[model samples]
Target: MNKHLLADRVKALTPSSTLAITAKAKELKAQGVDVIGLGAGEPDFNTPDHIIEAAYESMKAGETKYTPAAGTADLKKAVSQKFEKDQHIAYSPDEIFVGSGAKHVLYCLFQAILNEADEVIIPTPYWVSYPEQVKLAGGTPVYVEGKESNHYKITADQLRAAATEKTKAIIINSPSNPTGMIYSKEELSSLAEVCVENNILMVSDEIYEKLTYGEEKHISIASISEEFKKQTIIVNGVSKSHSMTGWRIGYAAGEKAIIKAMTNLASHSTSNPTTTAQFGALAAYTGTQQPVEEMRAAFEGRLNQVFDSLNAIQGFRCLKPQGAFYLFPNVKEAAVSCGFTTVDEFAADLLEKANVAVIPGSGFGSDDNIRLSYATDLKSFKEAIKRIAAYVNEHSSASD
Candidate 1:
């Protein structure tokens, strides 16, 4: 028998749907077709000036070589201080592990913690990588739906029901990707209680912590109590908060054993995050936070300005997002009205016909919904919404 060219694990991984859609949009743009893409997950803004300056200064000062497998002490210290200041939860440098990016840190974490057939419970409407990561680590992904009626949040009772002897961890993403929904303090308290009782690790992805708006606040599950803190591992970075996505600096904070294990795994893989980028991240935490808030205010303004317009399209229903830059609207009705049987088809048609690109929510584990990002400029975002509205009006049948 002929051997397979690739490992089974590699074959099983799903290509990132966000990136695929963005690539198609770029392909059309290359051909001179006007395409407004709402598929990008990162902020469209450039890195803050001080951050860039800090990286440049570090490079000039001969900080090019790596200092540790986990991270430089100064960078880890900055992260520790950041956790103290932002989450009100303290983490020593020993408990922190920095990797090239949050995605890389998460990959390292699953590698260190997961064993064959171990199960990780992930909420549906999750970030696309969670299940694939678990599978790559030789673990099974048990999904619990985060019902839209509950603002797309899974309840504590549902979590308890999902736990089993093999269940090792659960991820909680506040100001969630795709949906832009945040879990409230009371909701987190309930879920944390369940995790503690069941001895399940809580992986809190707080990369979007600084991007919340209005009355909604991002809360770290680790901040509820010392016991909860021990059970939770926080993954956050400057990528979203400071628009430093390309800088690739993200960290994890948790129990010493897990952090040490992740550090060891990272040593063999990425070694350390980019030395210059670490300095930029350090500056991001210690420097003035004015630019962070400035970006947050811009997102809020765009959300307010275009939300009503997007929500008013025929047969569309969008929950007002409290945080994050993406709007997830359930487009099942719209798809059916437009004579498309699936949201994916509708999304493709929008890209082809209306020249607007959106990420079909099927990739995020919700087939009925679609994600639209307001991370682009206000003018383009508004125009994209208008195009979508116009397309639906023209194609949708009133009798259907």
Candidate 2:
């Protein structure tokens, strides 16, 4: 006799391709293959010493048990102070809810708000989990394509077009995942005007808020206008900024009612982030930013190195990213010229032949691109690009 039961929701969801590729690279590495993985989403840097020390201190002080559903009062106050200092937005302690990670906070938000057939507008080349999370919350995901000419940023026109009565929310991730594209203040203003007119909820995922490079200033969409602030949920964490991914600490600031609902959801799900992690995050927010700045500088330097190397290859088109440590190159020209019919095939062949693991853009809702994370050291960046360039040049049918 066979006994099997799985929820339809669980069965219907597709596993994350980003995580899948990372796992595949791990499998090959265990077999002693020299696979260079460019698919990671977290920083390669270690958590700063001060943050670790804070966690240790917390544990020693008996802060190992559960706290409030929202978060520890100290961490919440620290998060509130951070928003005031950095974004110039003031959030009360009641307006913040912390969870296992920004990802978990996002999941709880969706779970709290979304109902059957509710629609969420997501820009293409988005983070891999956005659509899946929406689906799990019983919401329909409406993807609006952002073009390369626009730096893959969704326009006000697109926002206006995608809005409908069933629309519940729209996700905006600047210094976006897969593509390190950022929305300027003027651009966000335009989108905010549309959101304001339409009365739609904006979920701003700013996990990479502090990882921006160069002169590009990260703007919070809520900070654009009072109405926008009222409708927006700003999701942030110490994961990317402080290299604290494993700490599982992230928070959301928004309307008191929404925060309350999210906190209620968190209480049932995880019942607050780890006590030690909250203490660590508190330290991260209160500590000096020298470590964060050092990491950002290294990422910026590596970005330039990777861009120059990839551009030297035939048929590879790259856009210089303003923030984050990712390069989403348009490989369509190279893929076609190299006799590959699709981006997936191009990526698969490269992984099999060159042993370099990169995520295909199809996973991020684009068809003719592939994402490379430059979070590793310069040596790995150079070697990975060298292998990629050599493989592309050798495999090109145009060379014949």
Give the per-residue lDDT of model 1 (tens digit) for 1-400. 4577789999889999999999999999999999999999989889989989999999999999966999999989989988888778889899999999999989999998999999999998999999999999999999999999989999999999999999999999998997899999899999999998999999999999999988989999999899999999999888999999898989999999999999998888887888999999999999999999999999999999999999999988999998889999999999999999999999999999999999999999999999999999999999999999999989989744
Clashing pairs in 2: none
Poorest 10 consecutive residues by lDDT, candidate 2:
1-10
Positional deviation of residue 42's Cα in model 1 after best superposition, in angstroms: 1.1
Q: What are the lDDT figures for the candidates, one per model? A: 0.93, 0.90
Q: What's the lDDT for candidate 2?
A: 0.90
Task: Give TM per candidate.
Answer: 0.98, 0.98
lDDT of 2 by residue, 238-262 (tens): 9999999899899999999989999
Number of residue pairs clashing in candidate 2, backbone atoms closer than 3 angstroms, sequence gap of 3 or more or interchain: 0
Could you tell me the lDDT of residue 50 within candidate 1? 91
